[model samples]
Target: MEARLKFAVALGAALVLPAAVQGADYFVTRQGNDANRGADWATSFLTVQRGVDALKPGDTLTIGPGEYPENVKLHGFGVPGKETLIRAELAGTVVLRGDRDVDLDFAQVPGRRFVYIADCKMDVLSVHEVDTLTNLAPAADPGALEFGPARYWHDAEAGKLYLSTSDFQPATCHRYTIGVLRDHGVDMLQCRRVVLDGLAAAGYRTAVGKEGLLLPTSGFMLHQTEQCTVRRCTAFFNGSGITINSGVGGRTDQPGEGKGNLVEDCRAFANRLDGIVAYNPSGETIRNCQSFLNQTYGARFYGGRAGDAVCLMSDVLAWGNPGADFWTKGGGLSEYNEAVLAERCIALRDCNFGNFQHGIIGGRNVYRGDRPHTIILPGEHEEFHQFNDAHFADPMNFDFRLQATSSFRQSGEGEAASGPHPYKADIYHVKPGGNDDLDGLSLAAAWKTPSRAVARLKPGDTLYIAPGRYAGDLALTASNICIRGRGIEPVVIEGGLRLAECRDVSVERLQFSGPARAIRGGNIELANCVLFGQSVEAEQVEGLRLNHNLLVASLRLVGCSGVILNGNLHAAAPAVQTDTRQAVRYSSYN
Candidate 1:
């Protein structure tokens, strides 16, 4: 059966016209007019489902801006490269909404495995609107009825709902609000080439399973189909926002394939499960997306063929999530498969684990043996110094009254690489534009004046320093003032210095050694400056320059890439430990 399905699809693909050249328009409007041809803006159907029903190969359904009140399902209709488009009309909002206050019992649908709600809002039921029943008999008093109002009733037996208030009327009232009740939500299967644009799924009643008013069968569930696109949509407060069920044990019995699906620029928040899940599908891509505050992983990739799944996420941020910001369970996103690649992704305040994980809880599988893999860092060089054993003096113990010749003024080996300065500044006080009289009274103002001792003359002028012990850290910010340092041995800048965006700035041949970072600035040249942090103090400093410089953190550069290691890069602390046999080693360079 599966072979026959594949053959049929292959035949279909061969016979279908190229989708890019085919043009057809289907318009949707709030004012229902099915009789009107849905090809123009003026004559449009009110509901999205109507548009879906009318969708053909290579059709582009442009939905006009309005709030729709129905969950529409589009069965299979798609072609590769010529993907059908469903987009919002210019300056308009298209909403898919569920019927308010519908109930059904899921217990009645035997063998029912799943339900799906796509691009719609499921609203909650009001307490007063709930149906009430009472038993009655002849009363002793002529005016009195024999029976009283029934104390309890079931509203929703199985599915879900969207409610207006967080507070439940009766604690048990939540049981009957939404989900599988009579005439509840919509269900779709084997859908293809469907586009849900700028649609919101919200307003669910607070119930046990159907906490939100809109209890979907599932957010965007897929069983067996191909070529679909769900773009620029939001799904919130739903159970399992997006689920791709390929059958039991992450295996697919059907021969039909799910391919060429794209979910992009969408937001999923406060959902019960993962924002998106790809189950046993091949040739799918989820790009440039954001998911936050979901119950489970932000995005999950489960069972699939090797190299069949591709997730390209760039500039994405996930925060305050209980699970890992991005997780791959059930043999997904693991190096074992070599199919997943996560780049430039960040996780802030994620409590579950780091950015990546592998396999189900106990199912550990080694997909790759001792193969050479590349680990890319922000900077150009792969060499890193792990400062675990280095001990630094506590900043709290520092004495500002210490003499200029204090023992703390000594420079480390990497210190001489930085250029020299006149003022003898300590490691913590080496800032720009300051005056000290350690070797001899030297004022920033006097240093600027031209004389035989200085040769250079002018007020508000800056002086360059050579590589040596300086009495004080210089702090100079004057126009036409250029403080050049030696590039050979970085001039030792003793103290921590902070500079902001400035022009005509150059610092070379300087060793910054102290309890704090050496330099912090933008548009500044640090050619051969060595910044050594205090052995013990965790000082704050920007890692590198922004806009334009040798080392930067966040941005990418095309042709420029370099890294500098101050001393022997192979040096490690005695306590450093790793599983020698299990550890993957790589080439080292200085």
Candidate 2:
């Protein structure tokens, strides 16, 4: 954008569309009995399942703060417009667990597989990488360890556990015993408009099948369902904290049966695999979420096809994760069209990320402390470290917040620094018939191409694109900018939109034709838009909001949080969302 042009504007006002239906609220308390009607706090239900049976449309099931060791299955307790809500009244104090404590002796061990764990304080071991008992040798120190502390090996085939003889005896195993006993904490199958909030889930272990393949599980899952939301929740020490599965093994190319999903203000940590994951495509919106200290990627987006998936995120942080704190590839393929956008996001202290040759990255993002400390701009350059910075308050403590004398906060501000630019509502104009020769001031003299127009824009500026076919690729790096189409005629773009180091961008009322992809941007929202040819992808971005859009290929979202979808999404191909809290509303297939 032009260094001289300056304007600062916040995002559009949130529409107060409508409110959910009012319904009766039920309570579930530990001190209550199963026979109670669960109508009021005075006479609440003991078991959560009994409370589920009594739910109606738009019903609220308030679970008291306590640990509940049981696998919950939520069926069709939701109505069409209104949703069924389940939440802990006290938030973090409530835990829905999936583990059972079992006292053990060395005699019960399958092969004397006991070993020490180093939680980055020294060399550590992970159970997933163990191949043989003989290989459990000691490491030199934390730097030499491939895994982090207090990890144990599980012989899933034999149902045996290998623990440190010095640290854990049957009497001392209570700490380790605070784990999962079942496969899932809450499972949703063919449900609609369901909301889960303020719950903590943990302690899930994998089991080995006949072929020795480890069968993984999730803390909370939505399988073959539509319109679900999870928020203000913590998923830890499980195989996967949260997952949106469409079919068995998450193996399906079908368009995401679930649509318009949202996840916000959640945390996932200390999980076996990824902290958060998504399948079933059709995408989701993520915002203001955090994932860290997990075994693998902090958040991973997958289980969809290349050219079919899109995700949006902004204002998110993924730190202290060994694997690339956030990853955005689908099941087995990495295509340019598929993407995840992360804006004003951070990826700190990750082990590997530079190897991603076709990495989907966009928007004004800040990345530091990673192995490379440089991000691949895909077709733009091999390495681009535009907004990344290594200086921080403290790295050891995972404090990535900028210090008082930080420069990042300075550069983002326009240096006219004090004046109003020559635009109203902080929006500029661009048109097909307009020429680039003029000052490009008004709609009548709008710029013809995006190359010159984008350079003249400032942060919080809006590019009002007029209808007509325009060619050539467009790149946007300015934060809080909106590129919207004028409604008089169909605003068609021939090429694609590339975003890097961008933030709070909204693309609306535009139609992307041919091989055009709005790829690799963060805090992005595409509403009343149609995407064809390639997929629309967002990476490393959080606070995504996608609604009322038609996607011909896919929408890919990776390593994101606080994702939400309103309604009216049509996907011709598969869709994917990885490492995110997902919410879907009233969207349907094409």
Cα lDDT computed for each candidate against the true fold: 0.41, 0.57
- Those runs of model 1 whose alpha carbons end farther than 4 Å from true positions after fitting are 1-21, 90-92, 99-194, 203-216, 244-256, 304-315, 332-335, 349-590
Error of 2 at 55 (Å): 1.7
Candidate 1 CA-lDDT value: 0.41
lDDT of 1 by residue, 232-272 (tens): 77665445455554322335333245655666777766555
lDDT digits (tens) for residues 1-590 of candidate 2? 54333322211222322233367899998898888889998999987778877888688999986778777777645655878899887566578766543444434233323443322221122222221111122234323222433435554445545444322333133333434354667777767888889988766544323211112476777765566788888887667777665434445455445655566788887776677665644556555678877777676555563233456454556765766676655543233332444444555544222222211233222223222222322223222222222222222333333323333223443431111111133445677788888655455456788667887888867676767888876677777777777644678877776767667888787777754333344567778877775667766665666777777766666655555554545565456445544522112222
TM-score of candidate 1 versus the correct structure, residues matched by position? 0.43
Per-model TM-score, in order, reads 0.43, 0.51
CA lDDT of 574 in candidate 2? 57
Backbone clashes, candidate 1: 88
